[model samples]
Target: MKWWLIIILSLSIAFLGCEKTDKPTINEDGTKDNGKLESGGKNPKSKTGVWLTDWNDAMKTADVLNRPVFVDFTGSDWCIWCQKLEEEVFGKGEFLEYAKKNLVLLKVDFPRDIEQSEELQKFNEQKMKEYEIEGFPTIVLVNSKGEEIARTGYRPGGAKEYVKHLQELLQPKE
Candidate 1:
C-alpha cells in the first residue's frame, strides 16, 4: 500500500511539472482567438489591424486622432525574435486594451523569405530608408507633428510594462 501511494504521488508531480501551459487559442487560419487582437493591439472584435502599409496611410491615421504614432517594423515571417516577441508580449489581452485606447498603430513589414507585392516591398524599403531602420522588430513612437519621440525594441515584460513605457514616451519633453 505504501509503495503504491509513493508511485502515484511521484507520477502526479511529474505530470503536473510536464504539463504544457495553455496559450491563447490559435485559430484555423493561424491567428489567435478568431483574429482577436490581444496585448497592446487593436481589439479583434472591432475593426482592428488597420495597418498603415504606406507612409501616406500612416500620415492619414496620424492626422485623424492627432495622437502620437506607434510604428512597428517587423519581419512577420522568418524573424524568430519577432515571432517570440509577438507570441510572448503582443499576444496578451491587457496590452491590446491599452493600445486600443491610447495610440495609433502602424505596421511596416519587411519579409525576407516570402513573396510580397511590389508595392508592399517598395513601401517597406522606402520606410526603411526614411526611418533609417537597421533591425527587425524595432518600434518607433512619434508625435502628431511627425516628430520622433522614442525608439524601442522588443521587451519581455508584456502589456503592463509596455503601457508604462508608452506613457513615458507620450510625456512632454522636460
Candidate 2:
C-alpha cells in the first residue's frame, strides 16, 4: 500500500513539474507568427504585425521605421508575473495598437523548459548581461539607433495605464 502511495505521489509530482510552452511559428520572411505569444488568449496580430526574436533584425526594422524597439525580457515558461503582463497588457488591443504604431516589438525569452538554439541562447545571455537584467519581465525600450532609452517591468492597471506609462517613459526628459 505504501509503495502504491509513493508511486502515485511521484506521478503527481512529475505531472506538476511539466509545463506547456508555446513555440512561435517562424514565417518565410523571418518574422514570427504573433498568434503564439503566450498571451493567455488568442492573440491577434498587431497593426504593424511582426514580432522578431533576432536582435539584429529588430534593430534594422526599428531603424527603417524610425521607431523605438520594445524588448520584452521574459521567462515565458516559468514566471507568473510575465504571464500576467502578457495576459493583462500585451494581449489587450489597446497596447497592441499603441505598440504597432510606435514600437518594434522584440521578445527576448529566457524559458527554462523550452528549447532554444545555441546561437539564440548565447545572444540572449549576452543581451541580458549587456542590459544588466536582474529579473523576469524586464521591458527595455531602445531608440532607433539601438541605444537604451528606458527600462520597465510589470505594472498594474492594465493596458491603458501601461500604455500611458510607456508613453511617459518615451517622453524626452527636460
Top candidate (TM-score)? 2
How good is model 2 by TM-score?
0.72
C-alpha local distance difference test of each model: 0.71, 0.85
Model 2 RMSD, rounded to 1 decimal: 14.1
Candidate 2 residues lying further than 4 Å off, grouped into runs, are 1-47
- Range of the 10 consecutive residues with the lowest summed lDDT in candidate 1: 40-49
Clashing pairs in 2: none
Q: 19-94, model 1: which lDDT tens digit per residue?
A: 9764566644355653323334432323233445555545555655466677888998988888877777677776
Query: Distance from true position, residue 140, model 1, in Å?
Result: 0.8
The clash numbers for all candidates, in the given order, read 6, 0
**Candidate 1 local accuracy as lDDT?**
0.71
Per-candidate alpha-carbon RMSD to the true structure? 14.2, 14.1
Candidate 2 lDDT for residue 157: 100
Q: Report residue 113 deviation for candidate 1 (angstroms).
A: 4.0
